[model samples]
Target: MFRRRPARELSADDLLTTLGRLTAQARAGAELQRARVELAEALQREMLPAALPGVPGVRAAAAYAPARNGLDIGGDWYDGFPLPGGRLAFCIGDVQGHDVEAAAFMGQIRMGLRAVAGGGADPGVVLARANELLLSVDSPLFATCTFLTFDPVAWEVVAARAGHPPGVWATADGRCGIAEENGGAPLGVLPGETYPVTYWRLAPRGAFALLTDGVVEGPSFPIEAGLAEAAKRVRDRAPTGDPADVAAAVMDVAEFTGHTDDAAVVVLCYDRADRDNG
Candidate 1:
């Protein structure tokens, strides 16, 4: 058997070399993570609507902000479009988790909702059908969503929710309150859940808002408090302005700085002038 020589201890030079290599590896890993986050942000932006639809009897506006930490991408999304029967559909949703996968799932659910609504289904039916579609896909993620179909001709709005936050309703004279309704389980949670629809008369020159949790829930504030604060903000700013301006004003009150969750909002204003023109 050959005799083995004694092992020599690592010198400072050797240690320095090893540390340099480790540092380089860490830097490379961080760079790769940053690239992935950028890609996810871009993908999320691509999935959102470029502009909210302008219906004859309603003025609509939407705003979206991604997370400020980690991947900087979350499953918060908003959509508004005119349906076939001259009704306008507005939706806001937040999928579980903050990642690219959640965002992708959100896109699928939103498209499915639009398809079902286009078939002239009511808000409740649209959500029910969308839930079935998600189950068929076997999606592991679940989401909270609120859908509303506004019929300008009838001056009514039909609304449905799937574990989403209550919508804020404001009268033309600046009075505001939350419209609480019974909601079913979130989509992808139960195979056959029934969504209930609530009908409300649209107030002249009034507006309704759909928002994700990120807009209301924060570190220091509870959900109820946030809703109250938001309602006040809406009441103050919604008296006169375009939908877009109102949306911006409401979001400004949310104070998103240092918040971890993403936010999305959609404001639909029923101006008497628009109805008269239609």
Candidate 2:
């Protein structure tokens, strides 16, 4: 018959065995966590557009980088698609938090925005309607977004922001600056928020960049400094390459790995020759 031993009387072998079991359990837990992150990343990528739409007289491209550490998945997302009336719409947004819930919420928001924008409303009106839709949902997540509607025929763009980072615009002459316009509160925050639309003329041989906060706001950098750096990078690279190349170049210069948050960017370039000739 076996007798129960006192807690203090555990043998060295018993302690070693317990430690081994715990080590194995820890490794298994880590592996499971890694697998979850991978799955989340794949799901989030599905939410993003596989390729930017090919708009006449314009070149569009987008890039997304997941977080290097932590869950490797975030709410950052970018999308570009054709709208009615020969106009194109591009958007970038960031949902709160960096988990599966946030990713799911982001997907819903993107779909909602796309549906609302497709109805031919102005950028500001589309955002307002989107805000109302989000408020009607049961989600607790709030999101920041910047939406732009480009009219190739008029060579102009209208932009609206919901507490998101200002867009970067560069002219062919190398002049670059942030699109500082009046913006309303983030979606899901206040009901019936009115987002103001800012009108901008698209420069021939120029590019506009839209990015989530992860690209500009980091622990070591303030938003203003980061915005300046982004504008400078775009101005330096805007002289060459298409929108995709410019987007990649900007992402490289931004040093995304330095921060733990994911980054999403979209660049839209307009060529006067294409507009006039094509």
Candidate 3:
């Protein structure tokens, strides 16, 4: 009986051929998934601006850190461009989520802000228009952001925010203060909300820090604790030589353990005169 059953079974060659084809198909699927991930990452990197625009009487630099390991590039971004009145426009913002769609939405919001800001709109007006655009476009997504203007002649900087964390400002004597002002809800959150504008004068050699929540929100730490860490680094590394350096120091602290989210920061150090002459 056993001999008869064996004779009725398929040949070994046929079984091996079937197994080989199945393995090949599984490998092809894996390769395709990998290709998709790579494509997504490349697209994300392309979203960031190539270089920050030049601003009179200011040496500014910015840096962004993506997650330690993932397919997500990030939703955080910074932009520097000239305003209509010879003033400079600088902005930083972060979308609520991290994904391809979120990044696309971020690009749309950024372009809209630029269009409004380019028209010499104040920070408050810029935020309001941005909110309206988000709602009208039906691209409803929450975002925290700050818009700022720097006037070299007046040595002044005006800022406005929408549910973004307060920026950091440090005096010449090593004293640092958080820039807290009344703000409206984040964009695409609730329409018809108003964001108040705030003003501050930049002392010669003053340092200002604008950061995204990715730097503060973490697993083992709260926002306050993370802010404290940034302060300590700033104090210890007093008079950070450049904006990029300060950004790196902050990232070093947050990434000491690992990157939780996309960390982006803009550091502006006001010097009495341009370094190019020196």
| Per-prediction TM-score to the true structure, in the order listed | 0.92, 0.92, 0.83
Cα deviation of 123 in candidate 2 (Å)?
1.1
Question: In candidate 2, what are the lDDT values of residues 114-226, reduced to their tens digit?
Answer: 99998899999999999999999968899999998999888899999999999887877989999999999999889989999999877787888998777777777787887
* Span of ten consecutive residues with least summed lDDT in model 2: 251-260
- Candidate 1 Cα deviation (angstroms), residue 209: 0.8
Report the lDDT tens digits of candidate 3 across residue range 1-278: 35544565768998999999999999999787667657556655676677766564576678778875565556787887878766877889988766667777888888889988887878999999999889897875778899898887677899999989877777557887668778889988787878899988776776777888787667776777777677666554437547677767766666753457888888777765653344
Q: Once model 3 is optimally superposed onto the true structure by TM-score, how far is the C-alpha of residue 240 displaced, in angstroms? A: 4.2
**Model 1, 88-112: lDDT tens per residue?**
8889998997666877898898899
Against the unseen true structure, what C-alpha lDDT does each candidate score? 0.83, 0.85, 0.76
Worst 10 residues of 3 by lDDT: 269-278
How would the candidate models be sorted by lDDT, starting from the highest? 2, 1, 3
lDDT of 3: 0.76
Best by lDDT: 2
C-alpha lDDT (0 to 100) for residue 161 of candidate 2: 97
Where does candidate 2 clash, by residue pair? none
